[model samples]
Target: MSEPPRRNDDALTLLAVLTDDASRAQVATITGELGDRLLLATTIEEALAHAAREPIDLALVDVGIDGGAGLALVHHIPALRHDARVVAVAHRADLAHGADALAVGADALHLLPLAGDTVASTLAAARSRRLDARERHALAAALAAAHTTRRLYDRAMSALAAGEVSSAAGLFLEGLVAGGLAEGLALYTALGGAAVRVAAIGSLSAAPEEAAALEALARPGGIDGAYAPLRRDGSLVGALLVSGARATSTSILDLATLIATEYAAQRRARAAMTNIDDVGPALTTEEAFLAANEHEIARARRHCRRLTALVLRGCGESSALAVRRELRSSDLVARLGPDELVLLLPETDTLGAATCRRRLERRLRGLARDEGRGPLLVTSGAATFPHAGDSLAALLRAARARATAGAPYVALDRAVHALPLGELVPTLARGTLAHFPSVAPLDVPFPGLLALAEQLCVEAQRAGLATYLATDHPGRNLRAPARSLSARDARDAAPTPEAGQRDVRPDRRAASAQGSSVELRGVAHLAGCADLLVIVLRGEHASWAASGRLANDRFVGVHTHDPRLADLLAERLEEGHRRRNPESSP
Candidate 1:
C-alpha cells in the first residue's frame, strides 16, 4: 500500500486487480510495453484504496476476484476516478460476469488468456483517449479565459466612451494584467505642450532622461516600448508608457490607440463645455447687448452713417461711471462681463471713436488718481462700421482683437514696416483658419497674383460679403474677368454700372454702390499704392483683409482677419479715392 514514484502527466498509471497468475503477467507485459506505471491489488478493498489515492489512467479488473465481488469494484473504481478508463477481464467460461461488468460501469470487457497484441492495443487506445481528454479540457479553459478578456476589453471601451477616462484606464490595465502582462502602465496627457501623467498602474518610475525619451515617443514617430502617443486631429496630445516585458504587445498597442482616441475625445468635450461657459456676456446680459447692437447696426446701415463699438476690459464700476459721464446721451454703455464694458457710439467714424476713447481714458485716469489709485489699467478696442464690420458680432470680434492691457496698439503704418509683407502675411495666417480667420497669401508668380485676387473676390461676392477692391489698374483687374462680373451684375443689376468701373463718375459710382453699401474704388494713382493690391471684405459674422505690394515678382503685404485692420486699410484706400476725386461724398 506504499505510494509509487510520481509519474509524468503524459504517462498513464494502471491499477490491476487479479487472482490469476497468467492474467497478472499478461497485464504486466502490456503495461511495460506501454511505458505505464502498474499497481497490483490482491484484495477488492486494496483495489478500491488504490483507485481513491492513485492518479490512475487505466484500471484492469479481474471479474472473477473476491467470488465475483470485483464487479462491484469495477462500478466503484470509475466513480472514484472519473477520468480513469476501466476494462474488465474474465475467463471465457466466466463470460456471464464479464457481461455483468459491462452492464455496470466497465468501459470494455476483455477475455483471458488475453492476447498480447490485443491487450497492448487496448492499453495504447486507453492512453490515447486520456491524452485527447486532457487536450479538450485545456482548450476549454483557454476559451473561457479568452471570453473573460474580451468582456474586460468591452467594459473598458464602454466606460471610455461614456467619458469615464480614469475608470477606463484602470479597466484596461486590469485587462492587460489578466492577459498575463505583468507590467507597469502609465498614461500621460499633453497639457500646455508637456506630458503629464494622468492615469497609471503599478510602480513606474523613470529618471529624467528616460522620461524625456518617453515624451519623445509620444510625438509623431515610431512607437517604442517606452510610450505610445495619443493623437487628436493629427496632433499628439498624450502618451501611454509601459515598463517590463510584454510592453510592446499587439494588445497593448491596440489598447493604447483606443485609449488615446477616447481620452482626446474626452478632453475636447471638456474644452467645448469650458468655451460655452466662458462666452462674453452682452452689456448687462448677452441678449440685451446683442439686441441693442443689432438695432443700432441696422439703423446705421439704413442711414448710410458710421457706427463704432468699443470693448473695454478691466473697467471697474468707478471707471465705467466716469466713462458714462463723458459719453453723449445717444451713446450706449453696457456691462459686457464682470469687469468688461461695451460702448456703442452712433454716427462716429474711426477718428471720432478714437477721440471718444481718449476722452474716456483721460476721465477714468483723473478719477483713479483722485481716488489715490495709480495708472488706471483698462484695455480698449474700437471697431467702426464699413471699416471694422457690417454686423454687431463682427465689430465685437474686431474690437476684442485690438484690446490688450499694457500693450501698445500697433498702427497700420508701423505694422507695415515691422516685417516684410511676404513674410508677415504668412506668419499671421499660421494656425487654424477657424480661430484666426485670415487668408494666407500664397507665394505665387506675378500673373498668379491677378488670378488669386480674382478668385478671392469671386468667393467673397458669392458669400454675399461686402467686398472692396482698390488696385491702380481697376479696369484691367476686374474687367479681365468680365464674364464673372457680368453674371453677378445680371443677378444684382444696379443703375450705376459697378462701383470700380472707370467710366462712371466717382461721386455717382460711390452713391450707386451705397445701395449694397459696398465701396470698390479703382484709384487711377496713389503714392506707394501704385503697386499695392488691397482687398477688403466685410460680412455680418466676419471681416478680413488682404493687402500686398508687388515685390520680387510677388505680392507682399498683410492678410488679417482682424476687423479693425480691415477697417483701417479700407479707410486708407478711401482717403486715396477722396484725394483723387474732389467731389466724392465722404
Candidate 2:
C-alpha cells in the first residue's frame, strides 16, 4: 500500500476568543470546518498573552463577550503579532460595533447567525491578507539582498581596477557569502589538462570523476551541486563550484556571471602585460618586471631550485644599491618604479627571502637617519615559486597582495580619516573625479529617481550652496514640491500672476514643509533662490535640451547612466565659482 502524505510543519495556528459556552461551541465548529488548529482564549488578556508567546496566524474575537471588550481587543491582536489576521465577531444585537471594530484594526467583520459558508468566506479573506503580508516581507528581503550584492560587486570592481586579481577574488568570495552561500565555494582552474582548485572556502572533497565533470561542463548545471564555468575569450580559464540550495538562487547566478566576466577581463589585462615590453626597455616599468620575471621562474622550475619574487616599496636607488651589494650575482633585480622594485632571488626559499627583507629594512632605517629623512618606510612581500604560486601572474599577485596587507617598516600614518575636512574633502574629490562635468551613468528602478534627487540636495549642503534638484521625469512620483527654497517662503516661491513663472506649489494642507525634500516636480519655485541646479534626465525620456527652457543659470545635466552625480555637480559649482573670480584657482 502507498504511504500517507507527510504533514507540513508550517501549519497555521488560530486563536479564538469567546466567553459564552454557545459562542465557544460555534467557534469550535467554525475552526473545525476551516481545518486550522484552534487555541481557545476565554479573555482578551489570555489571547494577548498567548499571542506574545507564539506566532498567531489568525485571531477571532467575539464582540458580545464582556460588553464589547473583545471588540476592543481586536485592535491589539495585529500589534502583538504583525502577520496575524483578525476577524471581529458580533451577535445580531451587537452588530452596531462591527464597522467600528474593523476601523480600529480588524481585517474583517463576521456577523452573528454565523453559517458554515460565511465562516469559510471570512477565513478565505484572512488567508488572502496573510499571503499579501508574506509577499511584502519577501520583496523587502530580496531588495536588501540586491543592495548588499551591489555594494560587494562595486568593491570587487574597485579591487580589479587596481589590478589586484587575488584581492578581487577574495572580495568576490566575500560577496558570494554575503549573497547567502553558507559554505562549499571553490574556484578551480585548468592547468595541463587537469583541474586544480585555486581557492576554496571549505573542503572540495569531490572525487576525481566529479572534478573532471565539473571542469568539462560548459554551462552551469548540477545534480548534487552547481558549478559555473569561468571563461576568457571563448576559452575556459576555470570554474566556480558551489554546493547547497542557495547556489540555485538568481542572485548567485548573477554574481557568478559577474565574477566570470571580471576574470576574463583580468586575464586579458595579464596577457597585455606580457606584450608591454614592446613599449619600452625601462627597468622601472612594472610591466617590464612582470614580463622578464617569468623567464627566471621557468629556469628555477627546470633546475628544481626555489625562486622568490620580492615586491619592495618606499625605497630609492641608493637603498636598492645597498641591498644589491648584499645579493649574489645570480639574483636578478628589476626596478618597478621610483619607490617600487621587484627582486628575483635564485635558489632562495621563504626563509632566505625573509632574511633579505630584514637586512633591507635595517639598511633603509640607517639610510633614513643619515639623510635626515623621516624613517624610510619599507613595505615588502615575498612569493616563492612552486610553493606560494605556480604561475607568474599568480606569484606577482600574491606578493603584491602581501605587501599591501603588511605594514610599512617605518611609520607614515597616512590614514585618510585623520586629515581635516578642508584638506580631506579635496583629496577625496581628486581621487574620485579626474575631471569636471564628469558624465555619470544612472540606473533607476521605479522610485530610484527620487533617491537620486535627494542625493543632489545633500551634495549642495556639503558645498554650502542653496541648491535645486530638477528632473524632467514626468512620472507622478516626481510631482513633489521643493522644500526650503530660501529663507522666506514668499521670495521666488510665491505664486505670481506671470505666465510660465507661477510657483508650482504642492497642496500645503496635504504636505508638510519638508515635502519639497521628497519631490521637485517643477523649477518655478526655486527660480532665483538656488545658487546651483542639478537637472536629472532619463535617457529614454525628454532630456534637458528638450525640457522647455532654462530656469537656472548654472546647471549640469545628469543621466541615470552617469555615476557620481553629486561629485559632478559640486565640481560644476566650483568651476562656476572659479570662473566668477578670474584670479581664484579651483
Candidate number with greatest TM-score: 2
Q: What lDDT would candidate 1 get against the real structure?
A: 0.63
How many residue pairs clash in all the candidates, one count each? 2, 12
Q: What does candidate 1's lDDT look like per residue over 1-586, in tens digits?
A: 3234445656678888877778778877767655668888878999989988887888888888767888888778878988888899898878899999998878898887777776788777887898888899888876776677677787776555433566777777666656645466677666445555556666453312124533575465433346556655677766766666454666566566666555544454444333321223433556556654554565567457677888888777677777776776456677767887888776566545654665566577678779998665676888889777898889988998878622343333234423433343344445323333344544556677567555655665565424444544543453342234345645665353323222222222122133223345655375444566666655433565777666677766557666655655665667667777879743
**TM-scores for the candidates:** 0.42, 0.44
**Which sections of candidate 2 miss by over 4 Å?**
1-11, 20-23, 96-100, 180-183, 191-196, 202-225, 245-319, 322-586
lDDT, candidate 2, 1-586, per-residue tens: 1112222443456787766566566656766655666778888788878888868888878866777777777777788887788888888778777777878877777766566676667667767777777889889887887678678777666554433445556666666666665455666655545554544554333523235634564344442346677655677766776765364555554545545444444444445455542213455566555555555565456446566788888667677777666665445566666667777765555545654665566577677778888645777888877777887677778888888865631232233313432333333334433332333433334344445544544443333223343433344334342233232223334232223211222212111122122224232233332322234321111111101122232122234223223323333333344444557651
Candidate 2 Cα lDDT to native: 0.54
lDDT of model 1, residue 39:
88
